[model samples]
Target chain A: MRQFFGWLSLVVLMVFLVIGALFIMRPFGEPPSVMDDYIIDNAQEEAASNNVVAAVLFDYRGFDTLGEATVLFAAVTGALLVLRASHKKEET
Target chain B: MSKIVRTVANQLILFVVIFGLYVIIQGHVTPGGGFQGGAIIASGAVLLIVASGSQEIKTWLRERRLSVVESSGALLFILLAFAGIGTVFFFNFLVGSRLFGGIPSVGPNPGDVWTGGVIPLMNLGVGLKVMAGLSAVVLALALFSGGEELEE
Candidate 1:
């Protein structure tokens, strides 16, 4: 009885997700291009980099990269901490 | 690991490091970037570990050293971002200076290595961070499984 309800809920959630995606998402390759067009056209001249993607990542949207680096730092720190604790436990 | 596997990994690591650096340095003019290049170098580290085990690898590629490299990379990245703060945060202040400030001719042309301003430097910093961070994690995991701990 509970299994039936679970399956029904899963199906209903999947249906809702699919419907939402269909309605909310734009078609492929047709993203909102107001900013994209501007970046594509001006990135080279402004950032002085040939690769627009690199320019966008490091120049225009640098804060995002900084945030990403912070996340990586935190994750590595956490992993090292957890792994190092094992040796401390064994020694004591 | 067999002797042949070890020899092959050793020989392949040189090319891997070269190619990863090429990808990272040319990131401003090509499809690849810091993350991709760093991943390639980390794969080289993984190759060494798999061929020789982490015990043999730990003598040089210690966890403490890797942590330092990661910190340096993060520091360089943030410092470069802060350097431009006189104008605005994250400004491309090197756009027209003499260092890496050559403005490439508009439209499709051969890409210049010295034309990326701060982008290439940023790539280098990110590449170092990713390479060290991943290699350290892998080494830590291998060490833990081998009933060892990273040197303090």
Candidate 2:
């Protein structure tokens, strides 16, 4: 009886998840075209780089890229430290 | 499944690595760039690891060598970026220029293999960084999985 209720709740959650996904994907009456044009016009001036995508990623939105690099460095450092610690424990 | 299939797969991986290098080298004018090509090249290494053994891969990824390669690549990238600033940042330093003037502009032709100032160097740096980082990640995961057996 408890298992049955648990399964029923899971099914209900899944249905809600599907509905939420659909809501997010559903297009409005018209798509906004202005944003794309704005991006192209300003991208070069702000970044000053030839490759538009690289300029966007490394120059215009550099802070975000910095944050991302920091996160990656942190993760790598943590993993290396953890492994070193485990090796030390084994040796002792 | 069979030995023949495994051999064929290994040959296919070899072909992919060569093709990936071709893409990376021609990235300036071509569709594929360093990151995409690097990842594909790294995938070939991964295929070797999977087909072979961890010990073999470990031998290939000598810790000191990988660390040196990764560090040097990063340093090179920084230096290249700084070179732009050093040149007053008026124009991109690394982009190739036509040698219209005899002694003054006597350099590699624009859009040539050696052109695109720091782009090729940047690509080389990115390739090293990605390959070493990915190898390190795979090594860590392998170690983790190997350690799991001891737990049980």
Best by lDDT: 1
Runs with alpha carbons beyond 4 Å of true place in candidate 2: A1-51, A54-71, B1-6, B87-91, B98-115, B147-152
Model 1: residues with Cα > 4 Å off, grouped in runs: A1-33, B147-152
Instruction: Give the per-residue lDDT of model 1 (tens digit) for A1-92.
Output: 99999999999999999999899987888877588889988998899888898999999999999999999999999999998898668668
lDDT, candidates in the order shown = 0.90, 0.56
Native interface contacts kept by each candidate, as a fraction: 0.84, 0.03
Give one digit per residue, the lDDT tens place, for model 1 in B1-152: 77888899999999999999999999999998988999999999999988877888978779889999999999999999999999999998888789775799998898889998889999999999999999899888888654543332
DockQ of each: 0.61, 0.06
Interface RMSD of each: 1.0, 6.7
Model 1 lDDT at residue A61: 97
Which candidate wins on DockQ? 1
Candidate 2 residue lDDT tens string, B1-152: 34564577678887978877776665543455556676787677667656655565676665446556656656665565566676443224534345211111222223334444445556566566655556565665565444532110
Tell the DockQ for candidate 2.
0.06
